[model samples]
Target chain A: MADPMKIRATASGDVCEIKVLMSHPMETGQRKESDGKIVPAHFIQTFTIAVNGKTVIDAGTGTSVSRNPVFGFKVKGPKAGDKVTVSWVDNLGDKRTDEATVA
Target chain B: MDATRRTLLRGMGSTGLLAAAIAAGVLKPTRVFAAEYNKVAFEAKDLAGGLKGIGAASPAESKDIVLSAPEIAENGAVVSVTVASKIPGTSALAVFVEKNPMPLSAHFQFLNGALPEARLNVKMSQTSLIKAVALANGKAYMAQKEVKVTMGGCGG
Candidate 1:
């Protein structure tokens, strides 16, 4: 099982700003181990953000993203107390989903 | 010695079969779901190929697309990047590190009620030009910034 993500959604006026921090190695296959073996590539491939059960952002990322990535975005309609959900799936089949309420 | 030999043989046998299947186009690189992940764009080796893979071969330069990145990065492992598209009907946004092994770093599709802006961190193998592209009304626009990295990040 992967670690849970940390999500924060704060409303300023009608726009709700969201920030997320995910935990993952984000290994690139090009790296070599100290013993000369190559490390397998493993990274988050897809993620989705939803506000009040409505999908707002459907995204894809490559291995170039930094390890334990931090991502931020904004949505226009959500007000305080609206539910915001986020989910991510990695290349190795690990997945995590977490949610926060707009404040 | 014999046990190690047996394990090695077993590994090779399975990998050989998997390689054959992939070569014959019987399997893909294994995507988790039907999310809007474009395999070709993420695997493209160069800027032109990456742009074409994302369905924007010749995007026009636009001022409405803003790319915010540092002019000089002390560390290549984590460089902050933010892209904002003010185009009225912007639907998608893509970020590209021009010199990375795979130039395309990320792509995001915005649905109704979402803003076309994102902030994230990306790795660069070296100093390179980072480009942000916005798609709107069947057309693509782009903005780029050059970031100087003092240390390389791709190699461990």
Candidate 2:
């Protein structure tokens, strides 16, 4: 199982700013271990953001992203009380989902 | 060591059983949380190949598409990037690091009321041109920035 993500959503003037921080190794496969063995690629491959049950952002990322990735996005029409959900799935099939209230 | 081997064998046994269940239709696999990852685009090795894989082989350069990145990065392992598209009807955005073994870094699809902007951190193998592409109204617009990396990110 993967660690839970940290999510923050804030609304101002009908627009919401959402930020996500995910935990993962984000191995690039080209990297070698201390023993000279190649590290297998392991990274978050897909993620999604939703506001009040409506999908807002769908994303696909490769191994070029840094470990423990952080992402930010903006959306319109979200209010202070709306639910903002963020989910991510990794190359190993591990996944985590977390949510925050628009503040 | 023998105990550890036994545990590993047990884990493998369970995995084989799980696969059998999936194949037998008893445990249907589900990918409800995420859409399919773009393997072809993410695996492209060069800028031109990445652009072609992402279906933006000849994107028009546009000032409205903003790609914000540091001019010099002390750590190539973590370079902050932000891309914003002011073009109307923009629906998707992608970032590419021209020198990485696989240049395509990320792709974002916006729907409903989502804005055409995104911020993330990426790895750069070395000094490279970073390109941001925005798909709008069935066309592609792009912006680029050169970031000098003090250290390479892809090697261990």
Candidate 3:
């Protein structure tokens, strides 16, 4: 269990800069707890980015990402003031969606 | 002068209690607080300046900002790291893993107007200390964390 993810970015050329820190354990289902039960793997598997409703980038993930994962990315041809929506779905049937205006 | 005398007595009472406690060892030991900022500790040649342009310099950094990676890499490999800073006028962030043959793993320059905080993940070549240096307000600061690799890359 984690708090809401935070995001911020800076544009660079055709890139619409983006940074995201989401709240989750991102457990790899590898380690056993004190009771000797293996923790179930739960992680962000898909991330999609769309600018003003036009898709720009998409990605996949794995257990390798950090706990309470943070992601940095860029979108091609996006400008400041443009609306960018970021959404992700983890294997646990949980989903998150957020929007931020470029600046 | 009665009120003044009472106040003085109370002050003295507290001071004496404090003194007694210290002499009896009830007070916790005082610690010298150290300021920590993300810094690098590997060889990056000119990567430190690039990181400076990105606003990640230690308030203690004295040279090239580094992101340490193993010399030969065990798994090919991916490594862990920590970065601290000691500079001033810093407003952005970047990370470099020096063993990958390309020093740079990620770069972060802040938002239009926002607080300065940068964190990231990188693939490393071998085992080395990951460093981060940040510059803020014309001053530099640095911090580092040691990452020991156990699998899949960075040369076992």
Candidate 4:
């Protein structure tokens, strides 16, 4: 299982800023190991963020993203204490979902 | 090792459930994986090809899309970038590094009430033009910025 995603949500005025730090290898399949074998591509393919059960962000990522990526974005209208969930699906069909509350 | 084992078991269980659902016609696999990763887009060698791979052609340069990045990066291995689109009804945003072996770095789709803004770190081979494309009302808008890298990131 992938590591649990760390999420932080803070509200400033009427907008809430959400930051996500995901633990992933994000291997590009181009690197060679000590024995010279190419690493297979394993990276997150899709990421979605929801606020109060309403879908807000859906993204497709590739191996070009660095390992353990940190994504930050702002959403309008989310107030303090609103539920925020973030999830991701990798190329290998692996999935992880974690949630936080707007503070 | 323990985490991997647990994840493997969980993955198997979900796959079995999905298979049963598909067999019973209760779920469409395609719909479940609606946003399939575009290999061609990620492997495109040039900006035009990259855009075409993502189904965008002749994107107009616009100011509504904001791309924020350091003018000079001390390390190319981890260059931070942020993109924000002010266009109403914006649906998607993508980033492409002009000089990288593969230009397209990341692509994001915005759903209901999700703002068109994202921050991510990408690898750059050297100095390059980073382009951000925004899809709004079925039109493609773009913004670009150049970043100088002191060290190459792509295995330099």
Interface RMSD of each: 4.4, 3.0, 17.7, 3.2
Per-model TM against the reference: 0.88, 0.88, 0.43, 0.84
User: Across residues A4-102, which tens digit of lDDT does each residue of candidate 2 receive?
Assistant: 888999899978999999989999989999999999887888899999888899999999999999999999999999999898877655677899999
Q: At residue B1, what lDDT does model 4 achieve?
A: 69
Q: Rate the local accuracy (lDDT) of all candidates.
A: 0.87, 0.87, 0.49, 0.83
Residue A91 in model 3: lDDT: 49
2 or 4, which is superior by lDDT? 2
By DockQ: ranked, best first = 2, 4, 1, 3
Candidate 3 Cα misplacement greater than 4 A, ranges:
A12-14, B1-156
Model 4: CA > 4 A from native: B1-29
Residue B119 local lDDT, model 3: 37
**lDDT score for residue B154 of model 2:** 84
**Candidate closer to the true structure by TM-score (higher is better), 1 or 4:** 1
lDDT of 1 by residue, B1-156 (tens): 656644543454324453344336654434224474577888888989989988899999999998999999999999999999999999999999999999999999999689999999999999999999999999999999999999977887
Weakest 10 consecutive residues of candidate 1 chain B by summed lDDT: B13-22
* lDDT tens digits by residue: candidate 2, B58-97: 9999999989999999999999999999999999999999
Off-target runs (Cα >4 Å) in candidate 2 are B1-33
lDDT of 4 by residue, B16-118 (tens): 4544554465543444554556767877878888899887778999999999999999988789999999888888999998888778999988776667899
Screening candidate 4 with a backbone cut-off below 3 angstroms (N, C-alpha, C), the clashing residue pairs are none
